[model samples]
Target: MGTATPHGARAHARAQHGTRTPTMPVVPATDWPAPPAGAGPLVWAETVAGGGYAHKVLARGTELRLTDLHGDACAHLVLLAAGRPWERFNAADTVKVQWNAYLRAGHLLLSAQGRVLATLVADTTDGRHDTLCGTSTLVLNTERYGDGATHCATPAGRELLTLAALKNGLDTRDLPPSVSFFQGVHVDANDGTLHFTGSAGPGGSVTLRAEQDLVVLLANVPHPLDPRPSYTSTALEVLAWRAEPTRPGDPLWDATPEGRRAFLNTAELLTCRGQS
Candidate 1:
């Protein structure tokens, strides 16, 4: 296993694996730099409405709680290691690593380098975590909702991601692929076709435990699978609190022995490059 380079360090895993190759991979011009600011201790949170964007550098051992204030809400998430933005969440790897397509409790969000970014510790959904539906774009939103919608409604998911990334010392190009929570998708095995349907009922929520210090970008725009009568957005809230320190016997570590190796790699990487 290999760790990430911090603040302004070289990426070491993308070539062997198809991880990100960024223009500013070593150091993004963001407010928070890897060795950590050391100015403030890690304790913070915020609530964002639907059609909103949020970005934060979440510390390791912290838990991020996302709540769907409304029943029909969707939250798209993009995650990257704080030290190495290039090492981002690999959805394909995650689906395959866990041997399950539907993201639920106990599923670990894997990075392209096979390291853990975050772990799904708890969820309040109807088991509809989706990766296939993708995100909504301005053009597509207009096409689906009509010309009036383009002008009246807030920006779609892509724009929201871009804006959030920029605020966090990243460009639109730095935005990682996203996972749409509270959205569901199923494939018609017989026909080999896929269909998007279902929701987590009302007040659905998910809790993620950060295994690595991370740059998290979130958008509360509608999911691509969403086909409501017209354009509708839902409000979502984000809460970050202290997470119990992870030890060798931690369930997530014990469940997936590989996860332990990944976390060690991240810890070592941060320790080394973060000090430089």
Candidate 2:
């Protein structure tokens, strides 16, 4: 008698034979844990496997959080205004405007127009995030690993982001400089060199609140600065829910003079564009 086939093998056989299998939604089942007490209604939830990517156009005020499950995922991020793709996240502006290279709970992600795109509402990584080192490229990963094509075992973060961009009506030229979370780097004060610090272990997370109707692209792949010889990364959990946008009197908006200016500029643009 023939041995029993594994369930996944059976499913693959059916798919190869043209048995229609529709793509599944990102929502979780009823048994999943509910959102925090005042987080508003849950809007999206999904787990991105290593070397994978996710993208969505979220409305203003939605709070999105990324969790480093199993302690090894590097989440590369790119933000763009939903309708105006050219106005996108400016990493240099973000660091220079704030006068800080390390980002945390209160820093605002800004665009070149001086508009606030999102606010870092929570950070549990103890400063394990990066603005200097961007995601991995095909050539870099190809040199490190044997193969770096999208179809290979270890795909480059740039390839993943390119695919995600295409799905959102964008191309390589529209892709902007990205910020990374979970893994980080620090400048050596003595020599002014850079050093890589791996993740902050499991269950660490960072949350951001959207300040505009934004396009968020994320790729979970090994950090380009990672010292590991073999390509490796773990899973990442993403959850977004409805929340209120920042108001003039919000503490975060008034945290600093420069930050307030950015917020005011954001509000001015929103009002002129007929958004409340």
Candidate 3:
């Protein structure tokens, strides 16, 4: 199926409310089990250099971690089912159907096929992120930041994802839409323009738990609306480990009425493939 809306638009019409701090009661986060303490051994890890990109395949029970090593990092992440790239993430459906504009912990990033790709199972930053105002584009960056500014557009992320999927014999055209982590953006209530309100501090982090085998692509770049004088983008640390299976009363599956239904859809999809 085609995208319900261009991810480039980042759902321009959607209004959002987010938190500057996790302490804000208005942006409550779900309870996640305490991660095993210490910087233990990881299955795989890398530091994505500023302006660089990377991609990987995360199994259904793998955890992907993004860390803001320099206190100011933006990671544009795109995801698609490893076995079905056409069934990619749908930002509009994720926002409208799930009744949420801002995503934090306990939220499922839904796909156009009504399947859950991953769950925002953990966030230790400001508890805010954007599925709207996708990564900067070549045309956009050149227009605003001048020539060569096109260096870090979101497609850079697609390129990485394509590279990662190459082992699977997939190409760039198979890449899909993405969500920006650490980009705490919000829509102006009165004017409806997107605002880059800033993001995570040093050591801050967010985690995505794969709901199915996923082709993950990412880049460390400036948010489209970032006001920093320079690109200011820096290296980001990507870490992975096995994720525990969800059980009865799991918060993400039970976060909302839509979440439950989405989880069911994910289960049915997996079951049909005999993965369940």
Across residues 129-239, which tens digit of lDDT does each residue of candidate 1 receive? 786666788788777765323224656888788787888788867766688888788878799577877676777878888878889988877777776766677777666
Q: State the displacement of the C-alpha of residue 122, model 3, in Å, after optimal TM-score superposition.
A: 1.0
Please tell me which model should have the higher lDDT, number 1 or number 2.
2
**C-alpha lDDT of residue 80 in model 3:** 87
Candidate 3 on 120-193: residue-level lDDT in tens? 87899876578887776666556665533324333334444445557566776765556888868888999989
- Sorting all predicted structures by lDDT, with the top scorer first, yields 2, 1, 3
* Better candidate by TM-score, 1 or 2: 2
User: What lDDT tens digits, residue by residue, belong to model 2 across residues 72-103?
Assistant: 99999999999899999999999999999899
Q: Model 2's lDDT to the true fold?
A: 0.88
lDDT of 3 at 59: 83
TM-score ranking of the models: 2, 3, 1
**Residue runs of model 2 more than 4 Å from their true location after superposition:** 1-25, 28-34
